[model samples]
Structures are given as structure tokens and as C-alpha cells.
Target: MMCFRQVTLSLILLLLGQATPSRLQSLGATKLRLVGPGSRPEEGRLEVLHNGQWGTVCDDNFALQEATVACRQLGFESALTWAHSAKYGQGEGPIWLDNVRCVGTESSLDQCSSNGWGISDCSHSEDIGVVCHPQRQRGYVSERVSNALGPQGRRLEEVRLKPILASAKRRNPVTEGAVEVKYEGQWRQVCDQGWTMNNSRVVCGMLGFPSQQPINSHYYRKVWNLKMKDPKSRLNSLTKKNSFWVHRVTCLGTEPHMASCQVQVSPARGKLRPACPGGMHAVVSCVPGPRFRPQKAKPPRRKDSWAQQEPKVRLRSGAQVGEGRIEVLMHHQWGTVCDHRWDLISASVVCRQLGFGSAREALFGAQLGQGLGPIHLSEVRCRGYERTLSDCRALEGSQNGCQHENDAAVRCNVPSMGFQNQVRLAGGRRPEEGVVEVQVEVNGIRRWGAVCSDHWGLTEAMVACRQLGLGFASHAIKDTWYWQGTPGAGEVVLSGVRCSGTELALQQCQRHGPVHCSHGAGRFSAGVSCTDSAPDLVMNAQLVQETAYLEDRPLSQLYCAHEENCLSKSADLMDWPYGYRRLLRFSSQIYNLGRADFRPKTGRHSWIWHQCHMHYHSIEVFTHYDLLTVNGSKVAEGHKASFCLEDTNCPTGLQRRYACANFGEQGVTVGCWDTYRHDIDCQWVDITDVGPGDYIFQVVVNPKFEVAESDFSNNMMQCRCKYDGHRVWLHNCHTGDSYRANAELSLEQEQRLRNNLI
Candidate 1:
């Protein structure tokens, strides 16, 4: 049936001769294929389908963003880096895409902002090739993230919250809002007709909620109607059009997804936007389980807020109720706990203390997303039965070299729902890596086949690897033509698989109700290369804090910095030889705390040489130093430019293997650090532009994520800044995963809120 459908669509498209690849996919045509050199499966000169003919993409303005779109369009995790000037080889066709600009998360090349199809100002010599990693290679598997892959069916593939009266985090199940369904790439409102509390229960469960509550729909209606009146709606610059879909859903309240429930759709659904009565949208309010209640001072044995003897703890950024990044309270501020010495036993204590049952998975390395503020506790050793983390043996400060990216998180619950069995890998020599195969129902016949490669991103591969018991996905492979997989697994059976990267299995990932692989299964079948471990890069927050100071740099000595755009925008107007630039100088020491080494994505053979710096730079833009206002806007930025990685310091037992002096192999070895001292050129943020009262001076490592690491949360370091014209004071320098104390005013507001919350 699928083949016949494809053939019929092909004939129709042949007759039209103007259909787009995305349009053809929507019509269920044969999957789009990027024809290129076949020697390297991970990278090739890219071609695109345009106006019924295949063509190449010009390298004009092609960079990481464009490369990412090309790689993702081919269904890989992300682009490591893109090659210009025909690195893979020139092609023999018209350039289809040029001046292609993308933010890197578009669903397809068609969706990204670009020049019109087949419109380019270049020839074949300017063709671009993209290198994609199917599963990400930059991340390491620090801890096993095991979550119950709950009951899932095609019926409830995705259910999202649409806020009316209040705002809620889009994917956080702990919040509440109206319910909507995703269909054919558009999020459509579910008709309120025949909707019941039982239906709400099913929607909530699909969103990882435990139960439902009464919604103030009338208030929501009032706020929703008043939305256009006031453009400043708190719900993320509100203004959403309504398109009602699928009326009359009946649930038994026990069905895991809405699949088992009876659904009644009108035959005239195609006519008049017509099906729902009164055009009312379905709304839901759910009770966040005990584990998900916003953090407070509540302890296991305390009824009083003032009795805070054990301190307080809470979770953040969890997909499900009992799962999240762990945060503890100390010294009247929120902070994170280090993952060193953390395990299931440690997670269980946090769970039980928070009134959650027990721990099912002890996640690590900011899997749920890193926290904010200080890392108050390190080397936490918890017994299975500890009443509180304080009752367990633990360190009180950040002396163990643990960074915020290594912050420990947890998923506390009962046994998993057996999602691991629903997904498998084949064609790889080892069990950990392969072309991914997942079980799904086609025409009511259950079978396993390769997934369509469309929007299969880092989060999607993470879920697949987790389900397969692979520690982490180092690459999301789209070129499966090279793999020798199981005989029957080449058939494409799934499409539009979108995951939050926090799902336990492929079953929990949302997909099209009908199979819709844009590039049908075979050659572009979804694949992943898994790893039990990968390198972890952490910026030395302590070093940044200790080395913080101010400098007055003369413009005469900043010709190279000016060439690199390392100085502020005001520098372009500055008087050349007479002016001085105020710089916030700080040393950066990045440590590799993971089991593997951190290497540049591109090899030294391909490194770019800069005449100004007189050195071969490994990464294009490795780090970003920004001076942000209290509300988070860049007031100034660093004079930093292209960087080279090498070990500058290590413990007694570890030997240094990399140096930039002679263009030697460069990498930050495990248990070692690579330092760019404060006195080095381009190591300072040029802050001469403004009179700043308070600001956030932040440094982020691997900001573009061209390479893999264990945790990204700690890659960013932020410090509170106070400046009076002559000098600047830097304090509370915390990693992204650590919580910096709020400004004094916000701190006071926090105390009142905490008191009221308690």
C-alpha cells in the first residue's frame, strides 16, 4: 500500500513538476534523498530537490547554522561543522539553496529562512558539505538515566499546554494549561465537545501527570478573549489562533494514552473548519504529585517553617513529576549538589525526604538541565534509608573539583514501564551502536522497522540510547546505507518523531499517527552510535572568581583585538592612539572531569590559520564573554577569538600530551586543565561602553557545541558585577548549574515568597 501510494504521488508530482520536497513529503511521496559521494557516510556534498529536479547548495553564507539544517534535514543529531569551497567535491547541478541562514533547530531546510529555491549567486565551486553526528558526540554518559517508559499509543502522541490565564513551562508536566494535539506539523486545539474529566485524566497521564483537577475555564475564556486587547500578555508574548480538531473523545480513565478510548470525528471535518461546537478549546488543570510541588522549607518531620533544621531541597526542569535536577537550600540561598559519589541510594534519600516514594534512576551530569547558584554540597554519600541528605555523609563546599555541569539529578518512582524492550539496535558490530529499530503498529499490525529521519535530534537519540541501555548517544547517524542491519528492519515505519530528550523510550516520543518518514526508511534510516562514556568539560568557576580584576588596555596595543572584533562596538569610533579600553580581565581554566578526553571536532590537518594571531586556531569561536545587564542583555563582550586547546596544568600522575606551540595534537586530557591566563591577549571583556551599576559577566565554553562533553550546564559561568566608573567588583561567580544568590531586592522578595509558600 505504501509503495503504491508513493508511486501514485510520484506520478502526480511528475505532472505538477513544481512540488517542493516538503510538500511532496506531506503528500506521502518517496522520501527526499541527498545524493552525494558515498565514501563517507557521515558527510558528503549535499544536494536538494527543487522544482522536480535535484540540485546542489551553494557555500555562500553557509556555516554551522546552515550545516545544521542540512544535517537535520537528512535526519542526524547536528552538524559538527560545515565545509565550504567544495570540501567533499563539487557537484554537477544548479545551486538550490544559498544565503541559507538557520538557528539550527528548524524541522527542515524548507522551514529555515533562506533565499528562494534554486536562487543562488554562485557556481559549483562554492558548494558546501555538512558533517553530521547522528547521536551527539560532545556529551558523556556520567550516570544511567533510567525512567519507566510508560504506556504509550499512537493516539496520544503529543499533548501540550496552551496557557490562557497563567504562563507555564511548555514541557514541564508539573504546570497547567489548556490541552492541544499535534497533527500534520501544526498544534491544533482539541474540541471541548464531549470532553470530560476522564479525558483530562488521559491527557494529563500522557503528559506524565498522575491525576487531574478542576480548571477555571471561565476565567481562562475571559483572559483569552482579552488577549488581543492587551498585547503584553504574560504568556510569552501571547497571541495564538485557534483551529479546533477531533471532537468527541471518550476515555475509560484507565487507558494509558487516548488510543484505547473511543474517538468520533465528523465526516465533514474537511469542510468549514467544521467539527467542534462553539469553537471552544479543551482545558485541563492537574495536581502536581507530591514530588513536583514547588520547593519549600518542608522537611519530613517538620510542620513549622521556622524549624528548618535539616535545610530544604527541591527539584527543577523534570519531564515527569518525580524527576528533576536536584537543588538544595543553604545560607538562605538555593544551590546544587555535586554528582561525585552520588547514586541511586543518594537519590532515594532526596525522594523519601520530599515525600516521594523512592528512587528509580540516579541521573547525573545535568541530564535534566543544570541548576543555578552555588554548589553547596559535594561528595554526597547517602544510605538507602537516610531521612535527609544532611543525615548522610557529605562535603559542604566545592573543593572536590566538581563543577555545576556535573550537578546530580534524579528520577524517583517505581519500576519502569518496560519501554526498553520496544526499541533495539542492529547492523553495528557492538550492541551499543547501530541503526535504530523501534516497534510500532502499522494498519493495526505490530512490527519493528527503521524510523524516518526528520527532526531526529540530540534529545531523540538520547531517549533511544537510554531505552537501549546505552549510557549516552555520541552520534545520531542518518546515513544507514553503510550499515548491515537485520533483514526486515530496513522498512520505514515511523515519522515525525519528536522527543523532549527526557523520555525513557521511543514509545514515549511523539510521532505522526500514520507513518511519515520524509525520507522513507532504507538509506536514511535513523541510526545512533552509543557510548558508555564521553569527555566532560567544565570551566573553573573558582579560577574565574579568584583571577577577576580590571585593566586599562591601550588601543595602540589592540590592533589584533580589533581585527578579531574582541573589543566593544564603541571601539570602532574610538580615537586610535589616544584612547584606552577598560577590560574585565579573568583567567579561564577548563577541566575535563569525565572518563574520556576532550578533542576538537575538526582535526588539526583541517585547522584554520589566522595571519593576525600567527597561530592555527582549532575552533572558530570557542568561547563567549558577555557583559549582561540585570535583565540579561549584552552591554559589552570579550575581545576573545579563535582558540587552541592544550593542557597547561595537571596533577602529578597525569602527563601532558598536547601543546599549541608546534601545532601538535591538541586536547584536554582527563583530570587535567587547559588555562588561558588573564594576561593573555583577548582574555578580557572590553567594557568601555557604559556606566553600569550592576551586571552579569558570563563566560561560556564550547558555546557553539561543536564538540561533545558530559554536561553543558557547567560550560557557562556567570558572576554578579558592580561597577563605579573607576573600578569593578566581581562576586558570586557561579557556574550555570550553580545558583548565584539573587540580587538583594530579589532576595528580599524571595524571603517573602518563601514565607508565604511555607
Candidate 2:
């Protein structure tokens, strides 16, 4: 058997000098033994004769496949047939056959071991043994013959194997056509036509050396020279830094060899040629073969002209189709039409588009406007036209601009009217003042009057007055009988007639008859008797002023007038005694008494006044003093103090008066004086024994701050001490007049003092 054959081979190998202890170790031989092929046989199991003994493979799941794999491992092809359990004989050793599957390509017998050996269960009881025979080697002689071929047949020309060695001397020596480069698995010459120090540096870089190191070391230059194969290939002459020929020549450029161009070599005694001088010129040519020109590229074809393309338009559902149906243009390929359906009726839109005036008319067939570009319209429904552009699809390909010289046109009309007239009320009084009388005359006749008051409760008066068919009176008759004793009175009268109770037109009544009117006490008449008895006991007549007569009036009436008028009066009125001399003089001489008459014949009297006085160095400043009456008053003897008083009552009328004054040296002037009532007139007289300085005085009036002047400028006044001897000085009068007393210390000054202390 297989063991006997292996023993014979082992004996034969022992006789030869090639067999050593290592060879014996690899074969696992203690001593050689002889056995026959059929001495032991097992199906689906592997047997090995090792150390002169036979062993089994425990095949728990061993079969023909595993046996074939074991046979092939012993250099046999595969199992010729399947063998069952103990078909040859049960081996004395443990059966290791278990779970074995193989593709029959294993390399050794012992490689086919299965599960743990020698168990009793039949599935685990099967064992494997091999009947292996020696395999003969093929192609052995051919292998020997192949190995006999010399290193020259296996030599690699693609890579250069020689190391570049440096010589001890000879710097910048000429190497004429002496260098070759390995390229494309071949040694090729490098042209030197345009070689330069830069090219030398590039070569030095390819060799992994610094550019300056190669240029400064003579050893490097010698090493480069040794690296060259041919020493006479024309790389000899080159010098000078700026020489044009010093640049490297490249395979892609004018020259293909290093020696084809001149190059500069360093003259330094110890410097080396830094690099191969042709690297910069060694670019691979893109052209085919060795030619330099690149092949010409092909051009693209032109696309079809837009006019020749088919006309197409896209439409959305629900879009109206008529003479104004949406249409697209086929120029430069078809595209959606923009909605430009416009005409005289809708020319406002066209006018907006062309930034023109309003559209006057729509012209077709080039009458008003011409259609130039492709008509792009959508949702266009022109009722004025006959044919829908979209329906006339064939027209899109026509020569006459889509078969229509005029796609659409519009005429615009410009507006001619200017701003119109409007009525604006310039001035009027409120209705609560018993029918505010207003006169509006376009030519010269009164047009409107007795308008309602801006506030409530008074509109009823206006309505009742108008209901009586009476025109507004020419002027306001305040306190007239018409308004007297009436809570909600509105009426018209004829004669002896107070407008306070009548609602009849002036022309409807007798000029001298008793006036018929309405009253706030409930509608009634002057001559007509009331069928119902008057209240047994009338409440005390509530004479509420419907309109504010003065600033001190009720709060509700205060705001009844225009806000500006009320504010002006409130602002200008100052704290001062009323019915003072200056105020009396002011009212007497300046106010228009004729216009202020409350009754037809009785004139209004001036009763209000405001006064203030002070003294400084014989200078008596009297504000609100009446100058018009001062000249007639007698002067007391002791240093008669006098002055030309200037009135400061603002919106109220003003008047001036001259009063002579006298005082002693050191200015025996009174600084202050109390305003007192003199025969129902208030006045401020000089007081003695008062010294010069700053002082404040306040006077209390029955109704302090009552404003008479409603004009904004004249309503308010303020008083302050003036060193200039004026009674009223407006600015900064409260603080003392010492400049140094309020000077603020600077930070730097304080800091300097602190440093000085330190």
C-alpha cells in the first residue's frame, strides 16, 4: 500500500545527498516502514500510516464526498466509489468520522479529520482510512529546462537598477551628449538645446536634493555625470545666467534631446550641476506620434429656424374662446401669449401698458397702432372683434404677421376736467349762544344762518327756530328777551319782540304785535295765554349761561367755545386784583363800546381789572396800570413818584398814561406795594421804607386768574424781579444774580486738589 510506497520513496531519498534531517521532519518519519496498498481499507474514512502505525478518521457524518476529498489530498483524483461502514474492516483506532463535506481539492491526508473519535452511536461510529498510492510528476523536465534560462532572459529594462555615484572633483565640466533618460521602458537621450539652471534644479528635485545643494556641490555634478550613459551626446556648451539657450528643451517642444540647447552651469569651484537640464522641456506631446499640432475638433450642427417650427398654444380649462381667445406666437419656437387683449373700451389697460393717456379708440388693420412682436395673450375675449386668434391656427403660419396686419390697437382719451368747487365755513359761533348767527354771501345776500351748536341740547333750538321759517338775525343779540327766562327756547317774533321766545318768521308777524316764541320753560308765547297753569311755585330761575361770558364761567361752558380760544384766555390771565386802575383805564379807552352793546341802545360797561406795582430807585414799574386816566389824578406831595406806564393785558385793549415821579439819593424807592380797592377801582400806590433787592408779592382776587382777552398773545403774564428796575423780567429771575456763587468745579481741579493733599 500507500505506506509501503512512501517507505520506498523515503529510502531512496535517504540515499541521495538532498535528504536531510529537515526533510525527514517534514515527512514525519521516525524510521521507514513498508506496507501494501490493500493492507487496510475503509469507506468514507481517512487512514494514515504514521510512525509505523495505522489511524482512522472519526466520521460521524462521513460519506463518499469526504473520502474522495481524502483520496485527492493523498495525490489521488477522487473516490472511485462509495464504501459503507466497516466495508473493508473496522480499525483498532478511534473513529473520528463526523459532519464531513468536501469538494475534493484538499492537499493532504491528515487534513480530513472529523468529530471526536471512536463513539458508539452508529451515526458517530463510521471511521475513515485512505488507500493512497504514489502520484507521478508531469512537466518536471520542462520546469528544469525553464529554470536553466539565464538572468538575461528575466532581466527588467523598465527600471534602472544602477545607483548614481558621486566623484570627488571636476565641477561644471562639459558632458557632450553624454546623458540618457529611461522612458517608456527604453533609454532615450535628453535634448540640451534650451537647458538651464532651472532644468538642472528640476533634475536635482527628481533625485530628491535641494536645488542650491546640487548647484553648490561639485560632488553632485560628478554624481550626475556618472548617471549618464553616453558621455558624448552634445550637452557641452552653456554659461551665463540670462542666456536664452539656458532654458531646458522638452519632448513636447522644439527639441527632444538634452544636448540640443545650451544651458548655464555654475562657475563656483565646489558647485554641482543641480539637475538634468531638459526636464522643463520634457512634457508629453498630445499629438499623435511625434508631431506637435493637436488634432482638429468637430463643430456642432445648427438647430432648425424658429419660423419653420410648428405653431403651438397651450390653453387652460374654463378659458373663454371667441375673437379674444388666448393665442401664442411661433417666433423662435412657440411660446405662451401674454394677456394684451385691449381696445378703446379697455384702453385704460393699454394706456397703462404703453404709459400713455386714456384710450380713446381701438384701431384694427394698422389704422391706429401696428402689431410688431409676436402676440402673446391669455384669457383674451374681445367682444369687439370677429375672429378668435386661437381658432385661426392656420393664420399663425401666414406671411402677413400671423395673417393679420393689425393684431390689436387702442385709442386713448385724456381727462379734461380740473378741481371743482367746495364750500368751506370760515368762521361761526356755537348754537348754545342762542342761535349762532352766520352769514354766507356768494354775491351780496345772506345765505345761511342759525346753524346748530356743536354740542348737544342746543340743536333742538336750531331746529325749532328753522321750523318757524325765520331767517338768521344780522347780529348776535346776547341777553335779548328771546333768550331770557328760557331753558330750551327757540322762536320768531315781529315787534317789541325778544328772539328768546318766538319761532315765527319776521315777515309773518306784525311789526308791533306781541312776539310769538318758544321757551326752555316749555314752548309758550309772549301774548298768548297758557291753557295749563304755570307751575304753582317756580323753582328759583336757573340762569345758566349757555355760552361762556368769561373764563370764570362754569366748566361745561368754558369748553363750549373753540378750544384754542379757551386755551388762549386761560394761558394769558395772571394773578392780579380786578377792577384795578390800569384795567379800568384800558377798558374805558380801548374796547369798542359800540359793538359790545348787549341791548339795542344800552352799551356794555368795563368792570374788570388786573394790577401789580413795585419801586426801584424812584423808578415805579406799574404793569396793568391805566395810563389814560392817570394824568387827571392828583399827586401826593412827598417826592411824587410818576411813570409812563405800559399796559401788559395782552389780547384785551391797551392804553398808556404818563405819571411824574421823584425820589431821594440812595434811591428811597419802595420794592413792593399792596393793590387796594379805591372807590370800586383797584390801584397800586408807592410804599415807603422798602429797600432794593429781590422780593415776591402775591395778590388774591375774588376770582383769581379770570381771563378777559381771548387772543393767544394777550391772555397770560408772569412777574419776576429785575435788577434793571423793570417790574416784569421773564428769564432766570428766581436765582440770585451772583455769577461766582453757582460756578461748578471741574473734575480736573478737584483731582488736583486731592493730589496736593496726598
Best by TM-score: 1
lDDT value for model 2: 0.25
Give the lowest summed-lDDT range of ten residues in model 2: 140-149
Question: Best by lDDT, which number?
Answer: 1
Q: Candidate 1, residue 39: CA error in Å? A: 65
RMSD of each: 26.1, 52.4
lDDT tens readout by residue for model 2, 276-339: 4433112210101101011342221222111123223321110011012122434222222321
lDDT of 1 at 689: 79
Candidate 1, residues 1-758, lDDT tens digits: the string is: 00000011122222223211211112112123333443333466666656545577888877898777666555455788887898766666577888888787766777766787777789888888777763421233332221111112122235666655444542343346767766545566677777798888656655544456677777766765575356665322322323554566766564334533555432222343443635456788754444344445233232322123343787764534466678886765678898755655567567656545446556666676655457989778653445577778889747877676677888764222346677889888788888899887667888888888787766677678877877667777778788776887778877888886556678777888877766776788888887766666778787888888889988899998788788888889988978899988989888886657888877878888888888877887788999898788888887354466888998787799888887688888877889999988889898887795988888888786566555566678777788898888886666665433222334334335446546
